[model samples]
Target: MATSEQMEAYSQFWSLTLGFAAPFALKAAVKLDIFNIVSKFSSEQGATLDEIIQELRIKHDADSIQAERLFRLLRFLVFKKVLALNGARYGLTPMSRLLVSHGSSSDVFVGGILSFCTSEVTQRSWQHVDAAIKRPGDSNAFVEAHGMEPQDYVAAHPEFWKVIEDFRLSISTATSATITRVYDGFKSVKRLVDVGGDTGSFLAQIVRLYPHIQAVNFDLPRVIANAPAYPGVENVPGDAMDFVPPGDGIFLKSFLHMFADADAAKIVKNCHSALESDGKIIICDMVMDEGKELHLQLDMMFLSGSQRYQRTKAGWKNLLESCGFGSVRFFEADPFSITEAIKN
Candidate 1:
């Protein structure tokens, strides 16, 4: 006979092993369009299993067994707190709402990110994690699995790029909301330049908040070609590595983290050269916190997929200070952190 503590420890180990089931279940829910259907009904009233099945367009004859399976899925989601149980019906929880497409209360939707993570290409890369670790700096799991770097892979597969672009936009949308709320340093900025501003989504939000500022949405030529025109914003196609357009305020969101220290420092130096005297460079990227499981997980993903890795607070400070920046300040935010550094 085993002690209760021993049994409990064994149970926890098994639970950890089967943790992949939750995300796969959520992916299935997204594929089946379950959350969107549940959103049609009020959370108080919720949606019955029968109603969900009907919305899903399942044949009536298969309902006996299929409905039971569907119920189990919803029940598991509720257990995970991705959904709420209202009497016998199911309702969307805050997490589930982020999976929904159009009817979500918040502007940010994470369904694309979820889809990209669970996609075949990404899943295959995860399978080679052990090999990636063994090889360390020499091999990337994504390249080992896909035969190319992520950018090259995305370039070859337009569909994957679309999913990636959507994921990028979702992140920008979420980060922009937090930035506009917490930081008011943009008030003094007369000219704003957004480096790697994909589709002008991030710059558009900033322009909306501070209409007085002249904004330049700077990105690659291919990226600029796809960007829609925004009022009081210019979409400039160029390479930031070579040169960045001059601006009093330069914004680099989710950009620097994609490079190693040498390349990142070069980019920072380029921004420094482009800035007017006493100008600022604002960076929104992950600052690794050892205590946060999410940060650790993301750092691992970065390590496995590319040459990039998340920086610690000290890493960010050193990079900025070495690149001719003064008065570096950090702001806390979910998913990503903000760092404001004024050019010396």
Candidate 2:
């Protein structure tokens, strides 16, 4: 017979397993624009369930059953603490307020991230995790489930890819802000080269913050073509693997995690070669550390030969030092780390 304590622990495991339900519910709420609808109709007393349903136009002639089901969903959200219910009305809580989409430029697309994370294409990858473990190497969950890489899959589905792209852009904006605020080494650099800089957003933020710094956003030719112009920032067309534009400072913001260690080392060597004698190399990325098990799980979800995975602090230090850089230092930021390495 199972002991009471052991059974209790098993029950807790089941509860943790059921955590998927919350994200699924949140995904539906995002699709229905529940938060936006509630925000639009909210008053001092908050909005009634009927008002929300009416605003969303989800009612039909057979109303009771559907209304009850919608009520159940709303009540789930209430139970999850994303919303609140008093009397017959529901109101947005701080958590729910994040779903409201409002911003003209450089807005963080929290809703887009929510949707993309729970989207069919992304969730499909999780379904094959078991298979990936059973059969390792070049056959990740994503590859097994989709029969193609993520970028190729996105190219085939333009509309869906746009949402993912929006999420990427939002992440880029947030990352740029963090790098700009915490890292001050940019002051010494006259020329900054952003290797694999996508859309020039990072360089744009950097040059605007430090007017004295001139930056080159270097990526593939097609990537450079689509980059937005920023004052004192030039978009250069070339592969970083082949050659990085010679500069006093080399910035690799979220660039290296996508490649395997060997390839990343090659890119780091390229940075070393391109950097001036006294110049510094800055890398903005997730650094695996203590109490980051959840981050490790998310890292594993990328899966495969040269997928986006984090490096440990020591791993980063060793990698930089191996690339002929000395005096490496790490600056911790929100869910990411900035590593600075000076040429030997």
Candidate 3:
């Protein structure tokens, strides 16, 4: 019933809509370790189905039927240009080569998306996107759809909790480049307090860099329960919302994005109060810009999953000002910012 121009628009829209198919396809590929196998085969000449199954040391039986299933999967990966197929052998494309194991380093390239997409909590919430978009105020999307909090369900089921933790540990590690870039000046910092510093993961680097600089790693008690006892680093279990330990430098990496404005304001205020006369607060969170295409997609992704959200440049400045922080400065080069301020 539409005109030619309208029909053309509709056709293009549907094609773009099919783009969602790629994420699921990629998730499946990563879950099956297809890319790692392909990359390994590339180092060898190439791998046939039997060779792939054997090399991967697959747990289950891989007979002719299973081999045929794997072949069909490889064909899809080949068609997607993530894997290269020469005659009957499979190899990795340049795009897929980054996922291979590096000596002993374990990097699951698509692990983040897989954990988010395939987690029982996230999977259940995916079914209610329409309801979430229609209904209005920001509520927990997972709870809204599933009728129970994701955390509660995760707590009740040990297997699901293990999967979630595996996904977190697999995805939370830093790339070497990112580590060097983010912590370029960490050696100069005198004393550091990592708020919500779950098990001293980020603080370990700082304490390692400056052997004398005391590190106070604060988080919920349960989170830092098994924290390793180190000489320069002190582990204390408590909520950052109610209180933060006093220190020279306050640090938070990717923790602020999990809180709403009021909660963030309180935490920042605590940080402001906790800092020594010459100290500053270090916030490492994604700053969103509406102008960038990728930023917009990331903004949407954050909105869909977590209730807490990113702040625009102006929004962050206002947030800082409201919390009695002065001299807010953002580094364009960094995904995070070292915003210095005083309590007046």
Predicted candidate 2 versus true structure: per-residue lDDT over 1-67, tens digit per residue: 9999999999999997997898889887877777777876544577888787786675233344367
* RMSD (CA, Å), each prediction: 2.3, 3.4, 3.7
Clashes of each: 0, 0, 0
| Worst-scoring 10-residue span by lDDT in model 1 | 57-66
Top candidate on TM-score is 1
- Models 1 onward score TM values of 0.93, 0.84, 0.80
Question: Residue by residue across 1-344, what tens digits does model 3's lDDT show?
Answer: 89999999999999887866666777766767766666654454678887887855553344433667677777777888877778878877665654454432233343554556556566667667566667777665665766766567766765776666654444335322354454455565687888977667556666665677789989898778867776677899999888899987887777887878988989999888888875677676667777777667656655555465788878778877897777776654334444444444
Predictions in order: lDDT = 0.87, 0.80, 0.68
Rank order by lDDT, top first?
1, 2, 3
What is the alpha-carbon lDDT of model 1 when measured against the actual structure?
Answer: 0.87
Least lDDT summed over 10 consecutive residues: which range in candidate 3?
Answer: 101-110
- Once fitted onto the true fold, the runs of candidate 2 whose alpha carbons sit more than 4 angstroms away are 41-51, 58-67, 79-81, 84-94, 103-107, 304-306
The order by descending TM-score is 1, 2, 3
lDDT for residue 163 in candidate 2, whole number 0-100: 75
